[model samples]
Target: MPRSEYVASIRSRIGTDLLLLPGVTAVIRDEDRFLLARHQHSGLWSLIGGAVEPGEEPGEAVIREVFEETAANVRVRRIVGVYGGHPMMVTYPNGDQVGYVTTAYDCELLSPATPDLDELLEVGWFERDEIKTLPRRTWIDRVIDDVPRGSV
Candidate 1:
């Protein structure tokens, strides 16, 4: 099936009007740098995360998503912030919408592993100074800014 059709199928299963539901993103840090992923769909870099499955807690979702997307095990250290998925609409390359409510977490990597290249085109650690240069939507900047310094 096409990507849009697949997303629609998933949304239909949720039984909600919102296109996207609750999800988690990990702001993983190793020393002063943060782990980031270059998304396969948008080609824009973002934190590793995905939707929280039905019946699963937000913390559980982040751990599962980090391993699935990046192949790196992580532990949620703190809740960085909860964000409206409305702003970060899951727009496919063709402009299809997949709605979501993202929960951004400050997490710590529990193991060293390479990211799954098929889902994430690039994965690496970026310093705070470099984070400013990454090609990200404005919501990312707002989320990161909300994280208190030295909290991670």
Candidate 2:
């Protein structure tokens, strides 16, 4: 999916100034491995998810986002955390500044993915030990470290 229409509209008026937005992140796991997407815009591996649309719940948004970005069907098992403040602030490649109030969830992939190349450079599953070797954003590492090992 593209930068959400709601966010796009907001960006049009705000330019690159910081915008506080509600979003969701999916921490999908398959046995001992976790699914992560290499962001096309950021070039950093991160959890698969996107913004919550108007009237959409964070849990619902994560399921939709996971499917849109990776073509993977998933069920949100539980929320890992509700995070914001400095850790959520980000500057996109186009200089759009956003501070996300993100509700992240642990998810179970119901099937294999057919990744959307426009949104992600690549998508793969990595074991916990292997995650340390990848170039990942702080939030990704934080979510992985924070979530319980046998949740989803």
Candidate 3:
């Protein structure tokens, strides 16, 4: 997906300099397994989530992000965690650097769906052991418990 208009406006002014932004993510869990998306750009398996649009609540953002990214309908169960810094910082292929303060939700999948392909390569559920083997963002340990670090 392209940068949100809100973000584009910021980039127009700052021009790829570091920007701290609010983001949301969903840890869509079904018992021991979790729903994750494989990003087309990074080739990393990550939680289903995205930035909080202007005037949107974090909860609403997570729900919207889940559906947009994976075509999955989800309900926010509760906030799982809030994180920032190293792992949350992103430098896009275009060199637009963003540091995200991400609000993560414990979400329940109302219905599973396919990945958008534009944003993701695949979307599916994986067990704890399986996830550890997949390439993942650094924040995986902060999101899921008792897992060894993942590839990438």
Count of backbone clashes, every candidate in sequence: 3, 0, 0
Identify the runs in model 1 with alpha carbons over 4 angstroms from their true place: 1-18
Predict model 2's lDDT versus the native.
0.84
Query: RMSD in Å for candidate 1, one decimal?
Result: 3.6
Candidate 3 lDDT over residue span 59-83, tens digit each = 9999999889878798777787788
All candidates: CA RMSD (Å): 3.6, 1.5, 4.1
Candidate-wise lDDT, in order: 0.75, 0.84, 0.84
Question: If both were scored by TM-score, which would come out higher, candidate 1 or candidate 3?
Answer: 3
Q: In candidate 1, where is summed lDDT lowest over 10 consecutive residues?
A: 1-10
Q: How close to the true structure is residue 144 of candidate 3, measured as C-alpha lDDT?
A: 81
Comparing 1 and 3 on lDDT, the stronger one: 3
CA deviation > 4 Å runs, candidate 3: 146-152
In model 2, how large is the Cα lDDT of residue 35? 86
Candidate 2: stretches off by over 4 Å: none
